[model samples]
Target: MWFFGFSTTNPRNYWIIGAIILVIILTLILKHLAIYLEYSHKHNQEDDESERYKGSSKIDCSKCCSGAIRTYALEELKSATRDFRIRIGVGATSVVYLAELGDGQFGAVKRVMEEKGGSKKMFLDEVSVLLRISHPNLVGLLGFCLDKGEQLLLLEYVPNKSLFDRMHTRHGQSSGTLSWSSRLSIALDIARALDYLHSVADPAVIHRDVKSSNILLVNDNHAKLADFGLCKLGHDIQSAQTPTTIKGSLGYVDTCYLNTGLVSPKSDVYSFGVLLLELITGLKSVQGSTTLAEWTEECRKNKNVEVMVGMLDSKLKGDVNVQQLHVLIDVANLALLENCHGRPDMNYIVDRISSCMEPDIQPELPV
Candidate 1:
């Protein structure tokens, strides 16, 4: 009998076929083994890196702090915060309280809840990033506590609250509207912070979350980028586009990051663009199902200055510099481009915004 032109009953033919089959099987087994070994090596490397940053459950003050971060005992924080009773802000993973540190200094103490798996990771991640970075426009980490099952972070206190509180809250609205100049200044501050993170830092940092809520303001309306929980560090711009889970606030999240599950500095640029739209329109990033970015893009498609100006935050009407406003809108358009490659780097953005603040054009204060 013949099998595919080979004699099936012949001993020599059978031996030849068996040898070929065995060789093919061996090749496949070797290929699979190589793949498994590669994957195991990569995974172990990642775990080691994470372990280096994660450190022990209890941090050692002597080694961790080189005058950059202080290690606080739980009792010290509890006493400063009055047992965490003066709640100033609250989020999914933590609660912040107004604390009176000694010597009449004030600070914000963040208490990380022990309820979720990601909570501890977030705490560790924030600490790791904060330890390595320092910028005037970025929130400063004063100290941290990892004692008796409590995780607390002590941060510099900014009295004016967050940009979100100033823009969206009833109290903020009643107090006084943020002048167009203040808005522009706040935008610049945040842009500088992002620039520092993306360009100046030794290992570039991707904020991962950039929104009005994460922007804390000082009395002079200077903005500080906060919340480094979801940040990622990359040795260079190209390496920054690491694939990871999609995590960010709605509307402000980069569409590219959302679609691909890979994050880059451009993701922060996209979110900053959304923030620019928020500054222009005074609209929440999301209202019902419509996103501020989507809404602004739709309006911008009309190509009518009047139509676009009509969308400005009502309080900003008549006070806005039409020329500057146009410049800002144009910048926003570039930053919010659907293609991440088309987005301008933060340095370019800083220049464009600086152009709008030409020395002669003074900001109009709110009435």
Candidate 2:
């Protein structure tokens, strides 16, 4: 029907059409409202969790970017750690205590030093960054305690201590040297961790400090990267350079970062190369003024496999497979390349290291 026919159409038909259009519009509005409410609720829940742990109005959780992290009362943590009596480790910025929580879950509690604004910032940064990430090879943060000016971070307890302790003597106890294959596997674990931080993480992350002491071992002696107070975020892996104050362990710090005050995932690659040198030679990163990188470069000049193998730990003298030594040297070279662009990314390092570990016989697990 034409215009006149439409005007003459049934009033019931017009009413039905209007009602259908109204329903469609209302449906869309309700869907949008639901989405917004869900988002707000998630944020509100995170806020409530923060408030529950703060214990007082003076402690503002908004001061820090705490997203989905559980907060524990100071007394609860004290009880878990037996009044902080089980001191398992001591570091420059924090003290580590082995904690047994109420839920029967064992964890590590790191009591951060908040002696100054800088130290406080480090604690907040660690909490903020760690909350955003979760990877098997990366240490997991379970919760935190912000009470009495004490900032405590609760973490998954790694029973085997650190790779450094295993590689070197500590407390006059011979922890025994890591097998050649074990070393390769540990390196692979660390590489995979870095790969996740560098590429897989949304907005990415730079481990700023990559060293033997920061690499913890689980029950199976599998490695997990720890200590994220020094981590920095990046928009993407390729454009990850961020100008910041130079911060990292001495020997492992990238020369490029120091020279330019710029940090990136490549800086971590350089540190990983130094770590490889430590693993290959069983040497301290810095023996007096000489760094592992310098020593490795000097060894490279000789261009001799036996000379390189000579750098392997004396304990591993006859134990290391020749093929493994070659693999380590090749990866070390690529990672230690002077040009940042020349250094292979963590993904490449993981692949190369994985190949080296292929021939290894995995240690049997108990039933």
Candidate 3:
């Protein structure tokens, strides 16, 4: 019954093996402790930053913390919003009211409904995300209110409303028809916004909702991406994908994401592609049961320029430059590819859209 290896049979060998195992365990424990300490330190720093604004009504606006978020009292917000009576927009989990803040500037106040657990989580998530990001094409977060069991966000007021209202509302009901130049410019603005989120932000952001309805137009018709409730941070732009509950608009959600429950920046690209199609065709992303993407797939697949041209928005029929329209269609097709990995990045999309606009032609707003 003698073992071939002395270490397997000897008592001294057993002790040595036990010591080795203990050392390995200790090393792992120490390594994990260090990681935990590092994370705690980072979390504490964020907490300190947040504590600066907690229960405070005024923004610092100091050089060190410029554009810091403010905390508003429940009564203050109620007063600013005129008792939340002036409704400007409504959504599934929130209602937006136009407000006149203490500074006398107009703002949009979004009051989150407390009926669902997910809405509470979304309110916190939006605050976390908005605090870290800023861009010309991103809606600015002026402040927030978390008093008296209410979750409210005060944001910059974009007077011109959303791109969806501008593009899809029935004639005589819409603000006005968006000219081709305006559409091109708006597309470019949103592309730049996505480019900023995907490439420039420290940890790239994925605007999980990228439909026209989430795009607000400014006085000049430049687009600003809004609704950060579903946004996610991607640490690695190339391969980061988060498994999350499917939450996005019906017509704009990416099919791959919808099927797999895995979302990435490419999902945003797919939604943006659908938006481009909407801009070009003047049709809802979902009309009846048919998707705009599906409706245009045949012409896009066959490269039938004539068919694509004929599908242009009626209002834009005579105004669009054929060359620019072709460029937009090509970009949209690339973005809507079945394989998420094949879609072009936002930066590339920005460049392609820029090429469509001549340097000298200024974007004309709806009259």
Compare the candidates by lDDT and give the number of the best one: 1
Query: What C-alpha lDDT values do all the predictions have?
Result: 0.80, 0.76, 0.79
lDDT of each residue in 172-205, candidate 1, tens digit only: 6767889988888889888989999999998989
Model 3 weakest 10-residue run by lDDT: 55-64
**Model 1 accuracy (lDDT, Cα):** 0.80
Runs off by more than 4 Å, candidate 3? 1-66, 102-104, 116-118, 171-174, 240-242, 361-367
* Model 3 Cα lDDT, one tens digit per residue, 143-258: 89888899999887887668877776552124567888778888888888888889888888988889887889884348788989888885884574556799789788888888
| Per-residue lDDT of model 2, residues 156-190, tens digit only | 77777787766775421255667777777788888
TM-score of 1: 0.78
Steric clash pairs (candidate 3):
none
What value of lDDT does candidate 2 attain over all alpha carbons? Answer: 0.76
Question: Candidate 1: where is the Cα deviation over 4 Å?
Answer: 1-68, 116-118, 240-242, 360-367
Residue 322 accuracy (lDDT) in model 3: 86
TM-score of each: 0.78, 0.77, 0.78
Global Cα lDDT for candidate 3: 0.79
